[model samples]
Target chain A: MAFINYSAREINCKLVYYGPGLCGKTTNLKCIYERTANDAKGKMISLATETERTLFFDFLPLALGEIRGFKTRFHLYTVPGQVFYDASRKLILKGVDGVVFVADSQEERFEANIESIENLRDNLTEQGFDIAQLPWVIQYNKRDLPNAMPLEELREALNPTGKIPEFEAEASNGKGVFETLKALAKLVLAELKKGGK
Target chain B: MSLTPQLVLLEEDQRQILDVAERLVRDANAKAVYLVDKNGQLVAEAGELKGIDTTSLASLVAGNIAASGGLAKLIGEEEFPTHFHQGERDNVHITLVAQRIILAVIFDDRSSLGLVRLRVKKAGNKLSELFDAIFKRAESELGDNVESPFAEISEEDIDNLFSD
Candidate 1:
């Protein structure tokens, strides 16, 4: 659901980044916050623990250039990827307009990637959104690592649907990061034009 | 139910809100300033403390307004007018304006609670009048398509916002 300010002529949408632990979800946001001109982004808040683990979530509000005259502001957030924080993840998914699944491309973390995707699917279904119909995309992050998984296999395991856009990204270096963001954004606008039934 | 249209504030009134924000910060020597609607759409903000991330915070505040309002409905009560959260690390004061808008300020630990409250009280009334006028304009120009407020701030202009 969206909160419309007919008075302001602006529409605010919430977009959350989801994935398993250490999957570069937060990193993707850090990169964007660093790259976006200060005025284009609002405060980037990372609620992390003493050891730097994301305790709750990473939040950033990005002002994508406007659409149809009105400013399109995306309130981007990232769920704590640890499995035990499943409840927290569910809470953040509330009223989300889109999801960016940041999968760890390393071979050793393959199972974590699978479980995270399953968790996302279950959570979205529980939230009353049909996974197939929602605006979504997948990013194979950490692609520059020496132990990264083969893109072909990663795709087969994570994105069998072949419908949502997929990008190979090294979030640390800002590779394909914007591509993934831009793709999901396009989908969001398309969904809105159809009235987001 | 009262269905009468409220008077609207013009662009100049909005400018007054900005002016108040600057005065509240400079004359008051406060930390950060924020003026949001009753719905929590951030209308304006100014000050230091980078990374405050108003985008998510505004929407979350709006969500808070919604959740609280929903709870009020469930209990068959009128809407809650205003709320405040004074945290150990930071202080937030939210004030109601024109009975339809909210003005909130996020400040540091050093600022005195007495100072923030006093400034907010004075600014709130001015904001209320401005917001009242804006609503009137909104009613009159309901169908006009407006460009994004962000569009007016160019890339260079945006970079300057955080250039220190």
Candidate 2:
């Protein structure tokens, strides 16, 4: 859900980055945190294991300038992608305004990617959100890997609809990170403008 | 089970909420009080917030509540309405208001847990009433098909935000 404070002249939205384990979900957030100007970003919090695998989520708050007089603030989050953390993932999606599904482009992780997207759809459905209606995009990460699957193959499997915007990204190098974010943000704002859920 | 997409807080609504929060801070003799939505958005805060990262606090508090709520369900309960964390120098008393917002009081040597809990209960009730009224107003406004403030937003406006 979006929080619009007329008194403060600010609008806050929640965006979630979801994917399978080791799919670069956390890396995407870290890249954005590093690239964002200090004044435009807040502290990025990661609840992860000692080995740095995400335990619960990683949160980053960004000030995406203003729309009209309202300051547009986005709270970005990434759920722990390990299968056992399904509970945490559902909790993080409670009030999501938009989502970015980061699919690992590695050929070996193909099945894992499908399983994760199915998990995403089921989770959203349990929360009463239809996957087709939500403002979301897909990011095919690890594009620089030697064993990465072809873009068309990934799309044919994951985004069969071909209606959702898709990006090819290598999050560690920050490629296509902001592009994915900006596209999702634009969709979210457009939804708000239409006064739709 | 679909949740509302937007929680619109108008100026008058904020004043009423802050008034309740400020009074709770004084009556509880606490260092600070914070009201956060279930989505982890900070609705309002009162008292000496210096040195406190309110944004982080709000998000963590919401996470705590959600996790705790999950635990409650595992035990066949609905939800835990209150949570207390006792520290050597300070303590936090968290309460759920109308199951929609969190009312948290951070207190130290100046106050006791018993007093903070008592005051929070009263303040929580008042806040619940205020929120119910606000929701009603918002729903009625929606029924009237009031124009969204962002209805006039242009693609250029969105492009400009990312231009920098």
Candidate 3:
């Protein structure tokens, strides 16, 4: 949930990145951490295994400057995307304000993408958050792959509801990364404007 | 369906929370005291926080408490009201207060966990009362004379956030 502290005049929101294993969820966060200026960002913490796979999560707190007179801070986190880590993923979604589903674009990983999306929907539903009504965005990551799936096919299969904003990205090179974050952040702010907080 | 949980702490309420946190540090001789929402948002902090990332601490503490809550439910318990972590140098004691908020005390060799827990118990009650009053005030005045702070923010203002 987004936390608005009136005493401090600050707005804090949690945004989680989720997808199947090796879907570049963690890479998306690392790219943002590198590109952000020092003054506008905080320490990036990764709880990972020996091989650097996210064991629990990767947290990066970014200050998107300010809006009006209040400081607007976004806490970005990535859930461990391996299928066996479903329990960890559910815990991370507890109070999430927004979500970015980073789908692997390789054609061979199509089924994995579908299963992960289903997993996301089921988990979100358990938390009483309907993805259709939540501030949601989808990133078809790893677009630079030789045999990446077509954008239309991916959209049809993953975002069949056609209600979410989607972005195409090559996360390692930092392409379309900010655009996805900015879009989701905007939606989150819009939701708050409705007194949804 | 809620974008964020509105933390409507008036200046006086904030002062009260800070005062209690400071007392917790003094009585327990702890390194720092942090009050966070169950959702991982840092509500306030006190004491000599030199190298601590309070934001990360708040988030991770909330996560730990949450996972513990899940375990409690699995075993047919209402909730695990408290969790204690004993590190070599610094030990942390986390307790639930007012249902949705958590109070955490980080202490070391200067004081024992018994002292910290005793101080936390007293301070936690004071905080619960303070927060309860704040919530009541928000409910009464929220939509009447006082509008939401975000009401005046324009689309341009939001768009400008990412311009740089």
Cα error of candidate 1 at position B19, Å: 19
The list of candidate 2 runs beyond 4 A from truth reads B140-147
Off by over 4 Å in 3: B2-5, B133-143
Which of the predicted structures, 1 or 3, would earn the higher DockQ when compared with the native?
3
Query: Of 1 and 3, which scores higher on lDDT?
Result: 3
Which window of ten consecutive residues has the lowest lDDT sum in model 3 chain A?
A188-197
In model 2, the clashing pairs are A1-A95
Chain B, per-candidate TM-score: 0.69, 0.93, 0.91
Fraction of the true interface contacts (Cα pairs closer than 8 Å across chains) found in each model: 0.03, 0.65, 0.55
Candidate 1 backbone collisions, by pair: A42-B53, A43-B53, B8-B133, B8-B134, B8-B136, B9-B133, B9-B134
Using lDDT as the yardstick, the better of models 2 and 3 is 2
In candidate 1, stretches whose alpha carbon ends up further than 4 angstroms from where it belongs are B1-56, B59-164
Q: TM-score of every model? A: 0.63, 0.97, 0.93
lDDT of 1 at B35: 64
> Tens-digit lDDT track for model 1 on A1-197?
33344355566666789999999999999999998888788888777899888877788887765544556677788989999887668767766778999999999999999999999999888867788888889999999999998998999999987877899999999998888887786666656545421
> Can you write out model 3's per-residue Cα lDDT over A83-130, one digit (the tens) per residue?
988888988887898999999999999999999999999999987888
Best by lDDT: 2
Residue A26 in candidate 3, Cα distance off native in Å: 0.4
